[model samples]
Target: MSDQPPSHGTPYPYAYGPPSYAAPPPFRIPDAFGWSWDMLRVHLKVLLAAMIPTVVVGLVLYAMYFWRLVPIWIDMAEPTTSSTVQLDRFQDLWATVGLLYAAALVVAIPLSLFHGNLVRMCLLIADGGTPSYRMILSTRRAGRVMVTTAVLLVAGVLGTILCLLPGIAFAAFSMFTLPLLLDRDLGTFAAIRGSFALVRAHLGLCLLTFGLLIAVAYAGTMLCFVGIAASMPLGTLILVYAYRSLQVTGRTV
Candidate 1:
């Protein structure tokens, strides 16, 4: 195939077999990050497609969390007839919340990495190639990235406590460590180095991608956090697609 899009303007490239279902095309990551508004307008449909499942899952998880709070609310709403019982309830609530938060890492940390790879896969499919969920699933098969995620998750929290700089910088620049590690089957230092290499020359694009993500995330939160379940996949797919595009083009991604 030619370096650019196919000679004909058909969006997809290969002659492939049936996908999961012949329903509609799955989501695609964009060719790269620095797309023109014109191009984005053209591909907005795929971006939306990439995001659907993410939003549904996020909404369901949120609903479950929200329901968990209902019992606490009911308890408080009941006449506080006794400060003793109220205090006991509050303690129990805190204990449960703490346990849940601690336990969540086992799930959340890995899911975080999966989410990143999923966006990358979307980009791959967008390039008129097959996107393999197995590619992403393979990344999680070993526990290395999972451990890194837990570390990063804590590092991220600690960074927040120390100063916003650490957190912000990690979010933008080092965000790819997990993806690099998983996709390339690299070690921690290697993944870190690879991520740095990937964005070394394109700091501006990386920062811009991060800025866009923050903007979208902010917008989603303002929408009663529906945006989280709503916007994350969409936001993430575009950014990942753009990044991969830049890298594959042998330009400073």
Candidate 2:
């Protein structure tokens, strides 16, 4: 048995070959950030191309969310004269809420699919390969991405309810789940476990990387969220760089 999957007579879209660049020096957060910045600079056009659709879709979803609230707004705008009218309004409100929940579920599917493709792109870039926006169209392994996201969400929420530290731990350990699944085609639980094991083996480094990534993202938020447009992708690239480094220097069972 081999870690590498059987070739399907294709160039193997994900990063799977030898190092394209020289071995990087010891893990440094600044170095990772600098490398990620350089990647963004070199690949800005393709990155923007892939990102534009996601932004457009997200804006559409946001509009749909507000549109769904129109009924509630109208119901509240008119003063009810009778108890029956009030009851009917309440029912409509609840029904509208239900519709919103359903819409969220529907939206999650495509968002998760887009997220997986983005992970694929990041991994490919980290491997020193130039990728196209067309790669974002791939829906392969989207189910794994959705399942892993759902599991992480549930586990993280439960951990948060128990204690804040537990939630942070779950998030930190599971950082590599997406990359593993998208790059290696690992199953949901397998990817989760592999991410956990890999992070645990290099706990200090992984934790520092995760913490700094969060801090950078938070800093972006403080700049009126316009910065998030830059921070979020940069953080992702930093993590992907770490993932690629770990994958090259170590092995996951």
Clashing residue pairs in candidate 2 (N, C-alpha, C atoms within 3 angstroms): none
Give lDDT tens digits, candidate 2, residues 1-253.
1111111233324577753444434666777778888887777777666665556665566567668778677877898779898887788887977787656656665677776777787777876677787887887876778888788777876887686889889999999988888878888899999999999887888998899889988986676555555676677788887786665544544
For each candidate in turn, give its C-alpha RMSD to the true structure in angstroms.
Answer: 10.4, 9.2
- Taken over the whole model, the C-alpha lDDT of each candidate is 0.58, 0.73
* lDDT of model 2 at position 82: 92
Task: Compare the candidates by lDDT and give the number of the best one.
Answer: 2
**Over 4 Å off, model 1:** 1-61, 67-100, 132-142, 197-200, 220-230, 245-253
What does the lDDT read for residue 91 in candidate 1? Answer: 90
Q: How many backbone clashes does candidate 2 have?
A: 0
Per-residue lDDT of model 1, residues 24-141, tens digit only: 2211223333332333345455544544555665566666666776798788778867879999989978876766566565557747555655555544554555554355444543
The residue-level lDDT of candidate 2 at 99 comes to 81
Look at candidate 2 and tell me the lDDT of residue 129.
Answer: 76
